[model samples]
Target chain A: METGTAAHDDAAREPVWTGLPPGLLKMRRLLLVVWLGLLTVVLGALLNLFAGPAWAAFALLPLALIVWGWVLLGRNWRSWRYAERADDLLISRGVLWHHETIVPYGRMQLVEVTSGPVERHFGLASVQLHTAAAATDATIPGLVPAEAERLRDRLTELGEARSAGL
Target chain B: MTTPGAEKDVPEAAEVVREQVPVVERRLHPVTPLRRAWAPVAVIIGWAVHDPNQAQEQLTRLTTITLLIGLAVFVPAAGLYGFLTWWFTHFSVTDTELRIRTGLLFRRTAHIRLERIQAVDVTQPLLARVAGVAKLKLDVVGTDKKDELAFLGEGEARALRAELLARAAGFAPETVHDVGEAPSQQLLHVPAGVLAVSLVLTGATWGSLAAALVVPPLLWLATHSVWTVLATALPLLGAAGASSVGRFVGEYDWTLGESPDGLRIDHGLLDRTHETVPPGRVQTVRIVEPLLWRRRGWVRVELDVAGSSNSVLVPVAPREIAESVVARVLPGVTVPPLPALSRPPRRAHWCVPLWWRGYGLAVTDTVFAARHGLLRRSLALVPHAKVQSVRLKQGPWERFWRLAEVHVDTGANGTVTARLRDAEEAAELLREQAERSRTGRRDARPDRWMA
Candidate 1:
């Protein structure tokens, strides 16, 4: 077959998208704010050492990125949503320049559920699905540990069933 | 990160056979074990060579006696360590899974489900070949961790590989031996002479060889021909040459064929390697034709399997043969028709690095093919069912020029991102590819057995 029909033109309704946990917005802001604060402080001290108050204004660059990041963090978190369809998992993320990733059940070889020390402090975890492809940037972060485990189990079950079934 | 520690129920007949086999515990080859003693022997020789005149003049009774005592203690200790290692690492094959248990202190066990097994590769290193042993490497689908039984008797390795394949393919135990020798049709063969010549012709391989040869002179210049430099450079020279030879061993006499088990590959001249890539194990197929090989119409076929990033099926073969192999592996994927388009009004071609080189991409009935590369031409086929995600990338320059790139990411393998001069066309390709992938996965029977 050389050519096939375009498949998305017939969709009647927008795909139902589920946004990320609101707690992630707070986590991201906290991390970015701390990081930016440390960077600005370090740069501020270095500026003081090198050129004094003449370069104090240059510290504003990090502040700008931090402020920009703070605002975009919420938007990015808001933009993060996953749609669990019948056969594939769709993860839409990013703001300004949007990205949507679809991982089919049959393509999944492993479902990993992990929680770092920071995420654990927030009682949040992430679920990562590994396919045959090397780089898998399709992870659903900021989910509750219980929810993450449940998703991991469900995806694993679906992966096994679909892969063997295929 | 997680291990499949639990065992599932296996067929009763198979279970009985597993118990009868009595859990085989095998050791690695003795070459590594013998290395333990040889290392000290080398050190002793090196020590004496350091100051022969001084050593002879200063050959005090205490020092000579100390040397004797040191050798006596070190040799036994190294032997003990080697024996413990050989005793500890062992793997057993049961009906439902292959279990590997290793470690002398902290016990670690890995259980691989039979259904998840992909391919079994039988390889023998030059050293191992002299000892009449082979390594059976099991490649499981979807995981990087490879299960290997190293340095086994040739017959045992063959038997184990057949049994593993039989278990993986859901075949009865009684028929595994018969299936191992299933009639296979030869597809392509590269004579050893051709392989050697090609190695020298490939710029990358030749570059490495030249670099390896140049190092000794470089070191001579740096060290002024010192003995210490000889010791260090000798290994570097030995290693580089050894690796080049190893590559030759692995790829020489390459033969690709098809059999009942799946794709059968037999390569290597001195150390023969017999590998079986079971049907449906391949994740992605790439047909690469280097600049030098283009005139000869030779293409290299590589597969991105669950096992390796670039598992080459054929290093160099006629284009027609390579095409047939690709067609067989990926039943219904094809190259796009000629006269490729450069979208976003040809004016935007300024954003692309090489506008005159041309771009080749097409959305086929069941797959997306992107064929573009200046010096090294390649055709990447991503079936709609195998598409992991579709991404549209527009850099600031591309945006100004009204162009974008559509990155078609297939799992594990690299992305086939086509930089098109048209943004709308890129978006359309993304939407269409994602949609096709969605619908294809929905309708396609993903089960291997069903196929």
Candidate 2:
């Protein structure tokens, strides 16, 4: 019974980490393919026309990188997770290297919800939290619009409730 | 923390504002024009210093005539412009704000709210000192730009600064009338000779001196050219010499004193700067001990003050004295010694192998301290209450070694960051630091400090 309670305590120490939705990964992969695919086609045609068809093999490099990046993007998306605790918010991201930023609710100066044209097309928005420190670049991207608004409102409320002097 | 009925009192506050008498607008001291226009006037004079009468070939008649005309037109124009600027600029202080009207054609007005003031600095440049006037610089929160009133009588500036600080602390302007120097006691003072010797012994100066000695010989051996050696040695020697001289002039007769208001720093030889660091505004305190200075048991203390540039608290002092100053600067906070700090595991050294041993972090009850540097050691201490945020970062190599860096950021630009600690410990530090910061902020003094 003591071990069971210890296990529960350990679990409580680690908050529930929420990963980004698969739609963001899909949208990013689509963007990568479109941009790199265009470059590959243009380069392949130019190499085939000017530098001989044998030189066209160089264009396949970008295509290969695209494939590698497609897989990497999914891993990166999976690695992007955030946790909300009683007093602060935690954001952890990156694949090869990791970064974790903890911004206490009281320290938050501004909470903004932003959606670009492309993100709006995908019905996605981002919530950016600004603390007094410029180094605290905590951004939660590619959430559904409704969830984004909810997060922004909730963060604003929490921030106001716990506001502190710099 | 607003009461529900506060909105109903808005009209009453408006009535109070309307009932208050208007403050009389004032202009800067008469010497302002001379102080403002001296730079351009000297520049023009320096440009015209080459006697046209002596240079036969270079100074053709047309060029000489043009030079004379240029000086004749520019000198008076600059002075007139300065006078015009001085005439147009007017300032007045109200109970709620300090307003300044400037610009000749555009007529710009700036209103600085009293509550937003972070610091009031009284500065006397060389020219201003000769003229017996000082400048008042207002460092306000929420903006990096400082609003300054140039060339006021020194006594007037001090009285105005006292009044401003009092008003910012929630006092009415009338209550602070006839304010004299804040009651202060001397905390520490670094002699000029110590400052000069410390500057000479700093790692940068010695490194440059070493480069001058070693590189020229090596270059002479390699190239068999005297000019190459001279070319390399002269600049290095000049740089080392100039840096020492500049630092000596700027930091001469450094003094730190404490008052109920805050810490006051008086320094500089040619330009005497009186900087008042209000209580609780210091974000971080750093103590630096260069390798050579370490032998002499001397260290430099610097402070990251909110809404102002980083300032040297003391140029050079003994280790104990520096520690005491730091303690005074940040009262009730403790800093752990290097050995008492938490260091990373052996494997974490793979990230920064040569400098790995230099990394250490300590969290006291109220302060978070980070120690780093090998040759020139530095210890940065930040009160937990001053922490704006905390971050943990890892690079690819650090990932391979499972090492991470934790950064505790304050509102100021400087950060107390510990590099190459165990990843798990760094994460734990981040979480615990946030909690400490929350509690620290909760316990910190309220915004209206004097009240």
Candidate 3:
């Protein structure tokens, strides 16, 4: 089928939305803070090598404290979101620069529902949809367990109906 | 389009039905006895060889230290393995789908519907054969993903094969014929002349034999003592004997069988490998004759397939047989007729590089070769679907005449390269072939073709 044909008008009209689980963002920020802290400590040590002992001593405490603060704030700053429209599932999130990906349901090949230990404890889950084409795939994270299951069923049904020449 | 308000076009309200459907069956793969013993063996060996005097060591009483360390590492590892065995050893085949769930920490479950499966190839490695198990590789069309459901009992493999074929037949009426039926007939078999020619052209057969005889003497000379010769030569002799046995077993036991489902090739001596390729999934077919094999009239048949990208199916047979087999598997995909065979223009003497010439240059060369067809010299170049890229190559000498060769890469399995000695001609040919491949339909459509 020609992808540009009028038959795909419905897909073009769909709005995109996405939401990531809070735990995932928290996990990412925790990693970033730890990395930043390590960088600061390494930089302080390198500066100690070049500067006089007094300068090294003066820099170490403040650098360590700043790193610690970053680590503390990172744990609290995690979050994500999603929205579904007529034709696409839009996912948006990032600590630094936000990214938005729109995935069309018709392109979906497989839908997977997964739960991690934290998600399990919180009764939450994530749904990932794979596409035949490498690009244009998306995952929606941080849904309530029941919502994730419902979405999985709906996506699977929609994928199958579309594949069957709907 | 029908009128919006027509009785047939009236929208019907969705009906609601309440039913209790069973949850999808969960399955875990069975743990092999060898795998279960591997960790314990490694732990015991490590404990026996561990040296405490190294800089990394902790000072402690050896017996107590070993016991504590072993318990700390082995206990959790064994327990985790046991848990994994329980969790991932299961698999389930429902009425309409197959599901494989695996992984310990991040559990992964893959599901494939019966209707989507294009072919199922049952492969048995050495361990699988000894364990009475086989791996089912299901290739589904319209998707690039490959799902491997392993450790099926040999009996289960057969049952699954029949069930899958039956389901396929139900969806596609053309496949209603018994899958067990043999193919119409094999178009070619390795002819004796071809075998002789292959043995001469490629010195591998004789070289192997020569190596077998020379290794013992070579070892004996190296050791310089009659008593030590036995120690040195015995291993070499054993290895050579084993290799010869392997070769013999492979040559004699090799069978290429044809069935309605696909072409089945089974070979190997101690560790047999069985591979099947349904015509539908074969992306491309190539007939190649290496320079050395030219005089012997031997050609290698290779097929590109979806699931077996890492492996190429090469059947060495007579040139004529190779042509016939290619025609049967892929019709109307071979190069057009040529006049006669001639010695390839002297490679060293050609004034301008001919390798880069367009179709016209190739035609001229083919026409020259056609005059001497009985000499057994000819080259056929066939391009496959979708020429995605074209590359031109030339060595330093050819660069003198602004000459370059062309190689066209297609989406198909095998590499389709053409050598044109003339750069301008090669460019023109590349353009023509690329355009033709883009517009033409594939020679064999997967949906209809069957072995």
RMSD per candidate (Å) reads 6.9, 5.8, 15.0
Comparing 2 and 3 by DockQ, which wins?
Answer: 2
Name every residue pair that clashes in candidate 1.
A132-B411, A132-B412, A133-B411, A133-B412, A134-B412, A165-B447, A166-B446, A166-B447, A166-B448
Give the per-residue lDDT digits (tens) of candidate 1, residues B255-361.
Answer: 88987667888888777888887776665677787889878777788886665433889987878877878877776655453454232356555755564255667
Q: For model 1, state the Cα shift of residue B276 in Å.
A: 1.3
Instruction: Please provide, for model 3 over B1-451, each residue's C-alpha lDDT reduced to its tens digit, 9 standing for 90 to 100.
Output: 1112323222241111101234345442364433443666677567655853552354344577787898799777776676565556556655446676666677777777755554566767777788887767776644333357565677767666665555443432223324433343443444444444454565455556676578657867677678676765566566655444544444434456666656666655556655555554554455555667766566666665543532334446766666666655544544334332122334423533443222222332111101112223334344333233334455555555555555544333334444424556655654444334333333434443432
Estimated TM-score per prediction?
Answer: 0.76, 0.87, 0.51
In model 1 chain A, the worst 10-residue window by lDDT is A1-10
lDDT of each: 0.70, 0.82, 0.51
Per-prediction DockQ, in order?
Answer: 0.33, 0.66, 0.02
Q: Flag the better candidate by TM-score, 2 or 3.
A: 2
**Tens digits of per-residue lDDT for model 1, A56-137:** 7788899999999998888878878987655567787765565656676666877888889999898889999877666557
Model 2 in CAPRI terms: which quality? medium
lDDT of 2 by residue, B330-367 (tens): 88875577788877788966677778888788889989
Model 1 chain B, poorest ten-residue lDDT window? B1-10
- Order of candidate numbers by DockQ, starting with the best: 2, 1, 3
